[model samples]
Target: MAYSTTIRRRRRTRRIDRAGNPAAIGRWLLFVAGLVALMVVVGGITRLTESGLSIAYWKPVSGILPPLDAEAWQRTFAAYQATPEYRLVNRGMTLDEFKSIFWWEYVHRLLGRLIGLAYGFPLLVLWMRRRIPSGLKPRLLLIFLLGGAQGLLGWFMVKSGLVHEPQVSHYRLAAHLLLAILIFSLLLWTALDLLEPRHGSRQRRWRAMAMVLLLLVVVQIGLGALVAGLKAGYAFNTWPKMGEHWLPPELFALKPFWRNFFDNAIMVQFLHRLNAMLVAGWCLLIAVSTWRFEAPPRTIAAALALLLLIVGQIWLGIVTLVEGVPVAIAAAHQAGAVLVLALTLYFLHMNRRTAHHL
Candidate 1:
């Protein structure tokens, strides 16, 4: 009886330990999501302040720390001066002004590094301790690696503007933004998986719609990035009309047809506006579908919240564009986008859960 009691106690201890494992993983996921959110805001500042190309060099290992002395600062500034941005845009910028932009990009990189450590060290510890399932280790490590790759891709994006071009490649900018959003979506989705139990029922239709909305949001964001890359927002400067008409003249004036969508400011901005309308329409549809159907309350709530957010985001976009992409409004517009992405992710996961149960 004594031995049996000891065995039972040990088993209970193991059970408790097992129970806490998921919560720890959940906490880490939440931390990563928060960090990604900060990265997005900082990224917006980098772009709005035109600070992205200030660093001029990518030192993945050594660049984590900003310059400490005047000599180091001069070297960094000298590199920036060599870039086309400095020659064409900020021809006579002082070192002090250069420092302002340098710090923003530096901080952006630093946050990324910290996020890696915060994710990786804990992940390794958990895996070694058998707290993380064997199956999850590979997927989680891929996420960690993607975060690292994002930094490299960022450098690649910056390198484009440092040459003949006055600004970064819109294509690279779109890819970078898409990658970041994908990382955020993956983290949030994984967190949902860990937080919730196996599904008892499923809603396939809503799930499909949720995913479609997500893809539309991502595409819209990519288009928005292209608009930013080209500084296209400055051209439109109005809501519901593009310089007096709903559609601009000769969207394919740039030639090859697709180049207009990717390269032309007027066409790119026009597409962004159109994409926003499509996203808002999809959100409204999802909201109505979720409300009318007898699915999970979370799904319904997420859809409704997303609908409201979509409306506000559209308004913010108009204000930002009409107001000439002012820093505050532009930043808010970007923040609103991330929020909408989060809500869509939430609803999609909920839909997945509902479907699994069914």
Candidate 2:
């Protein structure tokens, strides 16, 4: 009887350990998401401070440390001066000024590298120990690869401006921003997968609709990056109206219609403005749909939070544009995008939970 009782107790302990493993994975995923958010803010600073083109090379392994001596500094500064961005835009900038922007971009890249390690190392150990379920291992590996691709895309975006444009190409900038959003979305999705809560009382269609709105908002943010890349915000300082008219008369001034959308500042800024309106409308609709659902209070609450974030992001965008996209305001605006994205992801996660519950 004693031996039988001991075996039963051991089995109970094992069941309990396995029961809540998903929540632990959820928490770790949340932590990685937060780290990526920090990387985004740092990246925004690098762009706003005009530091992205400072490094001039992608030395992923050995580029973490900044130059410490005069010789090292001269070599780095000379590399920057060789770039078109330095020769045309910031001609004759002193070493001290170069250092300022250099550190911003350097730190941004360093953090990105660290984040990759932080994610991969622990994930390997967890997998080895069989802590992660077989179903999740593949998904987690894909997330890591996506993160790696994002880092490469970042360098490619920066490289575009270093040749002749004196600024990164808007298309490349948009690609970079989209990649970042993609990484964040995937991370949040993986986190949701780990949390496998039972579906709540909400319909699956409602959840799918919310996910669509969330993706639209992410695409809008990519356009916003184009606006920033071309320094377009500095031109259209007025909100809701682009310099007295709802749309600029010279929208198609560029030679080809396609050129206007890709190369013309007026068109890029207009698209970003129009997208904001669409995002707001969709957010409100999602919030209303979620409100009418008979789901857990937290699920509905996440939807409401998402609505508020969208509203706040629009307001921040206006302020940043009006203020000439000052470094701090611009950084805040970028950070706000991440915040709204996170909340939207959180709502989608809850929606998935609701679906499972049913």
Candidate 3:
């Protein structure tokens, strides 16, 4: 009887150990985050190539397989021809030209499907095995829901272009891009939180600063999305000044005054540049404050890393703008925004962990 009881206890211990495997969960989250990052880069390319409206319909399942034959390709192209994008902008485009644009949108949608599988399959398995921490289950589920919303939002943005106008509504475009960034940020933060072994001493002031910086990073990302949606970068094509003036004459020229922020290309581009400077300044403040306060080694390291990322991202943005938003440089700049946000969130998470312990 005693031997049997001891074996039962050991089995339960093993089950408990397996259920709370931090390394496995952390790695899974990181993998999902990577896919999200790739999706962002691919989405950037799709936007730059003007291929977003190529797919006239959104078939979550059937859409997986692209046009496999000439007939199907013709049908797909026909549907695209019905949309305003083709009618207004791509009029006179040939079948071959249509295929060129179609592939980018196809790959972008395909990546989204792949991300859903990569995230859902592992998540379901973990949940079934009771491996996910009870506290984390709801948060993980929220991320999954947010991912689904992003998919729907993508179609909504495309639909905008399909309707009356040849271009997508900048508002919907910004929403879609910001949602993607938010999802990425959450996944990364959750993974890092789980991976952290223990809490250190909290720096309340530093924590607050990190949180503020994280918010600023997100806002900057939204501004960038606006710039992309408006195709504003193509107009300025200069650094430091917009045609010999810090603020161009066309900036805020729109009626209602506020419309300029979202609808005015010159204003949108100028604001994006302005926000970049603000984010850089905030990052600098954090780095200097970290040194002044003599923050924990980990906090100090995160601050320095955040500063470095901000600098690199700013430089990339300048190059992308100066070069008229070339595909490669613009994509890198978009990815750099992801990296910057990731570091800022990581720093915030670290500080919060310490605060919780205190």
Q: Please name the candidate that would achieve the greatest lDDT relative to the true structure.
A: 3
Q: Could you tell me the lDDT of residue 28 within candidate 1?
A: 82
Error of 3 at 209 (Å): 1.0
Model 3, 1-358: lDDT tens digits are 9999999999989877766787678888988998999999899999998999999999999999999999999999999999888888889999999999999999999999999999999999989888887778888999999999999999999998888988998899999999998898888877876677475446788888887888788888998888888888887888899978986899868999989878999998888888888899998999999999888877888899989989999999999988888898998999898889888878888778452210
Query: What's model 2's lDDT at 120?
Result: 89
lDDT of 3 at 343: 84
Better of 1 and 3 by lDDT: 3
Runs in model 2 lying further than 4 Å from the true structure: 1-20, 199-201, 292-296, 353-358
- For residues 206-310, write the lDDT of model 2, one tens digit per residue: 678777877787778887888888788877898778998986798999996788887788898898888888988988887777677555677668778878888
Residue pairs whose backbone atoms clash in candidate 2? 198-356, 198-357, 199-354, 199-355, 199-356, 199-357, 199-358, 200-354
The segments of candidate 3 whose C-alpha lies over 4 angstroms from its true place after superposition are: 1-15, 353-358
TM-score (C-alpha) between model 1 and the true structure = 0.91
In model 3, how large is the Cα lDDT of residue 268?
82
**Candidate 1 residue lDDT tens string, 250-351:** 677987887897889999899999989999998888888877876678677778889999999999999998888899899999988999899888777776
Instruction: Sort the candidates on TM-score, descending order.
Output: 3, 1, 2
